[model samples]
Target: MAEALADKNRYAHAPRNADWTIDQDWASYTPEEHDRWNRLFARQARVLPGRACDAFLAAKQKLELSRAGIPDFAELSERLARLTGWRVVPVAGLIPDDAFFDHLANRRFPAGAFIRPERELDYLSEPDVFHDVFGHVPLLADPVYAEFLEAYGKGGQRALRRGQLHNLARLYWYTVEFGLLATPAGLRIFGAGILSSPGESVFSLEDSSPNRIAFDLERIMRTKYIISDYQQTYFVVESFEQLLAECYQDFGALYDDLRAQPDIEAHALCAGDRVLTQGDQHYFRARGMAAE
Candidate 1:
């Protein structure tokens, strides 16, 4: 797991502080860097209207995110605070789990301070400023989702103490990173990991290669997830309020009960799942056959 994390964060800039934070130095960004942000923003913006959840789209407009270039964290925080009491803080890269949880618990989001290079435009192992800001900041504008994040952070801290961090991490993965929302129109994306990537953004909603299941708290905590590729399944919530209500409960006993059960594979669907869309497994199966 440590090695996997290292590989995942190989591209992240090293931090100058113990807590993995650094000054954003918004003034120091080169024109090319700003151009990269603009290009990535424009690409995702064009696709998000129909693809992103209504809450996310509304938040994006409310935040006025199309101002071009990377956002100033100070300015972004000011605007976000006004809307939802959330603040965006600059981080050198991915920090320790405890530190991350602490930040979220305090209503502060630790965003990467650098942008991805042009050569790595389509893909990056580590989240850059574009992914952090463009993907995550918009959603922070929603009051319910913002509260859910804080609850998640507090839950994370408790989970860490109970040796249930893995379970909590899975919840984070399937929700904040790759969660979906079911609306009257159809399934929409609320996950930052899916929202930021042009390919995954489309593939998550339109493709027939991944499972779309209703958000079951225990089921999600028990399910495993993949980091190197697109998700095999996405847990969908009815609304941000639903997500918050589900997570706000006491997890102490739940964590104790979960420790006795075996983990479910990323691609395996358990019986009694409020299954929405059954996936073909085309993507993973093809990859497996290629490996064989």
Candidate 2:
């Protein structure tokens, strides 16, 4: 941790403020970077139509994210603030957890100022501006989801104080980053992790290899997550209101109990789970086979 804080290279692209925000310096992005953004945008455009939730698609259009290459944070935030009192701010990269919770708590979404290099276009563990803005910022326009995220942000601060950040992160991982939604048309992608990925954009909805289960607050907190590959399971929320209602629950006791319980494997199914699809786990099985 000490070494990380002292690393000068981390802050090379943008000067970090006390709060860890940096000016997006929108004009500084090169033509090549802009072209990459366009290429990524076009890729998702082909897959997201029937896959992304209604709110996300609508917000994407309203924000006019496809108008150009990379969007200027100032302009994007201005429009977002009008709709849901949320603002998009630029960060050097990943900020400390406390700072991140603070930003979300205050309706400020801290996006990475950098875009991934051309070689890493297909997938990246570290979020880039495209993932932050293209994947997350759109949903900030939905009033209910906006309220839920702010509440989650405030909850994060409390979770940190209670030494429950690990548990809290699963909720975020399952829902915020890789969540799905149950719709009449079928399951749709809502997670920025999926919305921004050309591969996940299709696999998440169409593939039969991952478990799809209904969203349960306690269950989500109990489950482990995969960081390096597509998830072994996906949680589906009924609606934004359904998701927002989860924020109203008292998590103090929940956290305490969870500390005493063992974590559920990412691919394990519990008795109470409302199974949407019983994934064959073929993806993981195939990977295991290939490794051997």
Candidate 3:
């Protein structure tokens, strides 16, 4: 059953366009596909209120995401453009690193054109339209985050030229995908990956199993992250402005400094880390013991 399911979800080749883009064909989505999207959205919606950052929740309503069904890219683009000059573009699947950076640099978010299968709703290897559009798009409405993404995109192009894409990717993994915010109400989620996953939504904040360390640019850049599991350590920033300020500068020198340093394990804590929550790592240890 697992083998057959894997085969069904496998991609033989990249989708249509030369640039890896395709028309969203908003009308072509079948009822089943839309239903899958609704299920994913509804599950996240129920758990996100106090957990998700204020910005995400505000934008969700602004974009009318809570209304019904999958949103049309054209309509979403119009709303996003009006807010922050950002727009959503449809892609077949993952695009090349350079191409991905190029899109962000221009304020164009390249989203996968498909939705996850109903059977694989909880886990999928690659991000689908629901993940791309729903998890990420609303945040793009905020001006600070919008500018930060464009800067990260531009910075990514330079990283590729410098052979520092790996380091740069770590920054994105920790911040854009799995970052947390220290808000007035306490720690809140701004990262798309955490906000999109119902299970992680609770585990990230409530679970006593993962480290919640303060965000440090160099610390995050040198850290390794898990691809197939929840992050063992999540970096927390005080504000979006702070995040933007830290990332706006040229990383050329920092990248040079990083090349000499050994990479930090995903869950390792350094002496200078501002320990927000020193997790017991119960989940991680359990997984390890099971593997053994």
Provide TM-scores for the models: 0.93, 0.94, 0.94
Residue-level lDDT of model 2, residues 129-247, one tens digit each, is 88999999999999999999999899999999998999999999999999999899999999999999988888888888888999999999999888888888999999989999986
Model 3 misplaced stretches (Cα beyond 4 Å): 1-15, 289-292
Number of clashing pairs, model 2? 0
Provide the global lDDT of candidate 1 against the true structure. Answer: 0.87
Candidate 1's residue-wise lDDT over 1-292, tens digit each?
A: 7674444443244445665677788898889888988999899988888889998989888888884898999998999999999999898677899999999999999998788866679998888898899888889999999999999999999988988999999998998989999999999999999999999999899989888999999999999888888888899999999999999988988898898989998888889998899898898788882111
List per-candidate RMSD values in Å: 3.5, 3.1, 2.6
The Cα error of candidate 2 at residue 127, in Å, is 0.4
List candidate 2 stretches off by more than 4 Å: 1-13, 289-292
Q: Please provide the root mean square deviation of candidate 1 (C-alpha atoms, Å).
A: 3.5
Note the residue pairs that clash in candidate 3.
Answer: none
What stretches of model 1 exceed 4 Å from their correct place?
1-18, 289-292
Question: Distance (Å) between predicted and true CA of 220, model 2?
Answer: 0.5
